[model samples]
Target: MKYVALFLIFLAAPALAQDDPAVAARAAAKALEQASEQLDDADSARDRVKALTTTVRAYEDGLSAMREGLRRVSLREMDLRADLAEREAEISDLLGALMTIGNSEAPVLALHPSGPTGTARAGMLLADVTPALATRATALKEDLKEVSDLRQLQQEAEQRLTEGLQGVQLARTELSQAIDSRTDLPRRFIEDPVRTAILIAGTDTLNDFAAGLGEITQDEEPGSLPAISDRKGYLELPVPGKILRGAGEEDAAGVERPGIVVGTRPRALVTTPTAATIRYVGPLLDYGLVTILEPQADLLFVLAGLDQVYGRIGQVLPAGSPVGLMGGEMPAADEGLSQSGEGGGAQWTETLYMEVREGDDPVDPLTWFSTDKG
Candidate 1:
């Protein structure tokens, strides 16, 4: 019965509200539900794209938390069952002893080999142990109840996970649609179609293409985008992810790039780190889809390898505006589980290639971006 203290190991689990997976799961569910409600009225919001983006991110976060909670519940339940099984013999003995003591007649229990003095001493001993025995019994009962509660929590979480998955999918679809139809951002200047085409056709490398970047637009009217030179080392990453490759780091092929590579979840949202004008938004050579943003004169932030490009060329976007989403579908239940802390399976597979240029000179992005900030 003392093994009831084994349940205390759960205290070391991740810090959730009250350190309970069920509570954390319920909180996640509430947030997910609220995001869903917002998604329903997204069309009525002043900035539908922003509202939908928030909803999509909320769903993503909620789903992630739910997955973690389910994992924790599973682990805790297995451990509790194992503890109970390992002490099965001890528990049986305790139960048997308690039963024997309960069923004995008071006169028989009172009888002692050493006479009245011995009997009175034995009675005093029993009274001393009663409180401890009752405490042990209570602890065991509580442990057993926790096991049952964990099982039920798992079932409820599975249903919530299903609903959360569906909700996120819908939110993503709406956000994509909203972005496609959006035409509210101001354009810095009109891009000259002929000049852009000529510039791309004459260039054989990224450097050459960037060298003639200014030639693509003839209007070149000064926009209202404020200078971000002071934000050089304070800008956040365009998306939530980990830096997989440092600037100029060699790959398996011994090739190096000037910018860092970030790996993130599939379909992760990408936003501008600072207010800038959209210099270019289209495919260029082997980089797949690309977006070139100019935050200041002669400076460019080039993001490549996007699945779908957002915003039109020459648009002046505010800081934190949605630029694009990474390629790939969200992992299904089985795959997602395998990607959690309890899992050793796959991880973030999508990568964003980023580079910063100062008038045709490729610069290291780490110096210009804050990789440690959210």
Candidate 2:
């Protein structure tokens, strides 16, 4: 819906994505690449990563600010347009009044002379004079000037609105691309052997990362939970669906695993509460069309079983909004393929998997999400 403030109007219903951590990471990395491209100085890998992360965060902020500015500009333009319309109407009314005064049917004098015409000579003389004509001419000129000025103002406002709207749209597009880039960036930098080593480090690392994110504990029993602040709430499913799997399972019912899972009817929109940065938004093993949201550094939100992702990374969004709809689930055999970072572009026909990580460890998402009877 368009936001209406008094006479102003602004479009506020554009889709927002930016809820995945992978997207954020990619953006951060790309920003560094751009900077390095321009600079002659050599920087360490760690330094580049740090610089890129900061730049990505700045761009995310820029996207949010641009969206807001566009909204305001649109509203202003609407008001200006309305004003122009009123001015035009006023000019028309003035012209009508002048026409009425100049019409020949209405004689000016009430007194009728005893002539063949039954009209006073003085009255006839005055009606024929140009005094009334001069007055009407002056009024017309003034009204025309007013109309012209209003039109000029309207045009300027429209131009501003156009530019602002374009900026906002461009920022959105950039963020989306940045997210896609970031989700794949890690794969380029970290080879399979390194990633496998990272994965094998232990679930404790995953748990610690998840703990930092403040996601629901896998085992919230005594001595099992970690210390972390609660989020506003877990990312709510945009619509009804079923929870398919938790993160980091080697096998499910005699099948290999890749990412976690969530199953839904075809084309059901997925969403999270509030806006968040995207951690990863792409295809993964078993988790077809996956997206990961990092509400904060400590919390990671993963979404799978999407037909398409609506939002981009580094963009803010509201919870329970549509991230994407459900596609086919991943097959058990292909589940582990995601870990290998090889298989992609496969159509959905298997189970869905989802994960929530703080940093590296995968935490049980079931504790936070409402029960799925399916």
Candidate 3:
């Protein structure tokens, strides 16, 4: 559905080009406002939870759209800069030729000519060159104006990118706080201190940790949580963005993984796709700040690359419950590759690494989530 909406938007570009940017920004702001209103108007805890989810997702979508716009503007700025350079060179050459003509010995020729016919010929040549010089001057003036406009556009694009990034950060902070406030759900799984300690002590690899976690029995009643098997091909994405990598694909390190990587806005909300028990939440190996969730007795989902985690080990959370958030701003680099950012920068890219397993066997998550790439 998200892809369809975007495709429709693209198709209407010719009609929307004049006002699309302002309209899109306004629409995003309006969506956020409406979500907030809904949250306030909600009469029940369930309604409020839904409202909060909408609010977070709206903010994520808004930020994503703004970033995309800024990227397009950046590309346009690069093209404009190239054009400006070429135009400047042309203007410089034209000016040089004009200067050479202006400093010519035509005046001396007028005073001392070989004959009347020679003088008439020189006069005709001067008349012909005058219009050409005027034309070149006019072109030079237009090129100067164009260069100035390009500079202004570039400056505007940079300003928009900075503002968009700041807005995303603020929205993310608000979403995090809202998620933290919802603590009304009953605990379905109690933390096993002994098991947790043993798992932490004995496990050195992800597989080993997962195996240890699988051994721990859940205190929650069976059939209490929703069955993920029943919702195949209709699950919402844990985050609101496009999928970057499909299952069985090789990552930057050239290791083939049984999961999908999603490219999301910086500090985007990361939530549970279904009700699940938290098995682990911490940094592990190259996967920073990972969160492991078990949707069923045998099914496990792994989410990695979080800047901050929310739930604790053995806690049962409802579907769409906040797990954590994507990392904050990072240095600008190739977004396609998964590289951790050094510090918060004006523009950054984040990748959410996700994996699914059923009874220790890896499964393709693309077959589970809705096909909508919104």
lDDT of each: 0.78, 0.42, 0.64
Report the C-alpha displacement of residue 155, candidate 3, in angstroms.
10
Candidate 1's C-alpha runs over 4 A off are: 1-18, 110-118, 334-347
Task: Give the candidate order by descending lDDT.
Answer: 1, 3, 2
Per residue, candidate 3 scores C-alpha lDDT tens digits across 10-101 of 33423212322334434544554554454445434464655555555664565444444434434444544565575565546556656766
Per-residue accuracy of model 1 over 45-103 as CA lDDT, tens digit each: 99888788788778877877777777777777776788778767766755665666689
The superposed Cα distance between candidate 1 and the true structure at residue 133, in angstroms, equals 2.5
TM-score of each: 0.86, 0.32, 0.60
Report the number of the highest-TM-score candidate. 1
Please list all clashing residue pairs in model 3, or write none if there are none: none
Q: Residue by residue across 218-278, what tens digits does model 2's lDDT show? A: 2222221133346333435434445455445556476543345655433333566445554
CA RMSD of each candidate after superposition: 4.2, 17.3, 11.6
Q: How close is candidate 2 to the true structure, as a TM-score?
A: 0.32
